[model samples]
Target: MRNVLITGGAGFIGSNLALKLVESGSNVTVLDNLSPQIHGDNPELSPLYRSILGKVKFIKGTVESRQDWNDALVGIDTVVHLAAETGTGQSMYQIKKYSDVNIGGSAILLDLMANEPHNISKMVIASSRSIYGEGKYLCKQHGIVYPNARSAEDMKLADFNVKCPVCSVSVELLATDEESKIHPSSIYGVTKQVQEQMFMITGQSLGIPTVSLRFQNVYGAGQSLSNPYTGILSIFSTRIKNGNDINIFEDGLESRDFIYIDDVVESIMLSIFKDEANYQIFNVGSGVCTDVLTVAETLKNVYQSNSSVSISGNYRVGDIRHNFADLTLIRSKVGFEPKIDFLNGIKKFTTWVNKQEIQKDLYEASIQEMKSKGLYK
Candidate 1:
């Protein structure tokens, strides 16, 4: 069994990936600070404090610290770096915080991996499509405003460009390929780009195989519903479940390529084991774009419940009008294909949300909870 270290393994994507590695009979070690912001005050995460945790070896620590990296790297053969301060809008205000973890922490990890005794062979990083920024290519094709209707001819070109009309962006913007230019609009995206570069350079210099997987909007079970800074699907589902109004920041026309957690995990696994994916970057997405309004409506339909939705003119700063992923690289490399369609993924997510016992909160409340738990401290 290969010894694998997963940083930020308590968070949604990291945790899901950890679970997958364990089930595949790998010796998985999860290194996490369990920042109350991500894990919450739930006692279940603590070994001495709870009985409901998974079987992987868990270490409570920060990736930003050198000592934590030293402790976690012992006997590790692979590292899947997924930790980041992932708030696009909030990063505008807290640029330093985003850089500290995403860039600084990653730099430290790469440095350690290079000097370590076990000689780490492979590393995979969790990247974001935000690095592409507000796709100018999309703006040129669809105009500043979205088209009222599109035809097969439009779709063919869109298929070539990878644009989305309802969102007023191209699949070229949505389905960003490996060659897509990096133009980060937010501090978060900027840091992710830096993080990717660090791994690429370090891996090449150190003779270690590194891969970066640019993930689309990922949503599934175990995501924190309390934070508006993360997990839109969870936030929407929880709000509708509680008889609260779901807020759409824009006209609900902006589209995103949302990928399920399972598919994302599979992509990571493929990246790790497959020699063909080394020193490469791949976009992990469903290759389809859906608007926010459609997602809200689908949630309402799946739950068989009625909930109000309000579309506000205010939108988050640096928020992409439309973004999706070009799946040509990953599909060709690992034979990766998203099996769960949008409606099916929504149904699964809604069902999971319906079964949860915990109460969900909005943006301000989420921040307040994080502060109260001493996460920021």
Candidate 2:
């Protein structure tokens, strides 16, 4: 049996992975701080944490602690680093918090790898599509070009589409490939970029195989419903749970590639065992773009709630217009393909959400917090 260490193993993606690892007979160890935002004040209050209680070893602490890393690394042969602050809007104002957790936490791992000796054979890091800021677009005059972030002035006029860099004409956002540009629009994105770079660079020099997964909008069961800072679906569902209206931002047409959690876990397992995936960065997405309007409508119908959908002519800073992953590279290299489509995945997610105790919706408060910081407009 292999020894696997999953940092942030209590969160949605990480917890699901931990379950998979435990069932497969791998000796599993979870290292997480159980941030109050995600797990509430008492971590044991979370069903996800309770599920893995008897199956795997658990450690509660921040990754920034060298002592915690030293402890979590004990007898661990494979590592999957998923610990971080994930709020895109909050990352803008809490610059030091995001940097300290994401970048600084990653530095601790690299430092330990450089100094300490262990049996670590491979590592898998959780990266994000955020690094591909305003990713690829087809410009009539410029062929394929990566545009800059959408302007606030354009949003005020309700012109929410991404424009061509050269001709300034509206452009179609295309599926981003692994070789696409690495320009991240948010501070969170920048930190993620640095996080992956440190792992790959340090892992290589230390003779450890590494895989950086650029995951796109992962959602499914066990997603935190109360955390308004992340998981749009969870936020929307919680609002609907409280009989609140659904607020659609940016004309309700901004699109993203949302992959189901099972598919993401499948891709991670593939990277863990495949020799060909070493020293590679792969994009894990459904390879299909689903617009925000479609998602809002779908969730409303599934929940059968009376909440009306509002296409608010509002926008937030550091948000991307549209992005989807070109999963060709990962498919070719690791033979990974998404089995759960958006509609089927939504049904499963809604089924799970219905069983849980309805959380008090904090959608407005989250917006107000961002608005106070000038992040929301």
- The TM-score leader among the candidates is 2
Worst lDDT window (10 residues) for model 1?
143-152
- Count backbone clashes in candidate 1: 12
Give the per-residue lDDT of model 1 (tens digit) for 1-377: 77899998877888788878888888888887776666566635532213215567788888899998888888899999998899776687777889899999998897776675655899999999888775434455454322222333543332323345456454343356778667776789999999999999999998899999998899876677656677778778768767777778656887888999889999999999999999999999888889888888888777776787777643454666677788988999888898888878877777777777645566557545445543321
lDDT scores in order: 0.76, 0.92
Per-residue lDDT of 124 in model 1: 96
Candidate 2, residues 1-377, lDDT tens digits: the string is 78999999988888999999887889999999988789866778888888788888999988999999999999999999999999999999999999999999989988988887888999999999999998898987889999888887888899988998787899977899999999999999999999999999998898899999999999998889889889888988998999999999988889899999999999999988899999999999998998888998999999998999999878888999899999999999999999999999999999999999998787899899999999888
lDDT measured at residue 318 in model 2 versus the true structure, 0 to 100? 94
lDDT for 37 (candidate 1) = 60
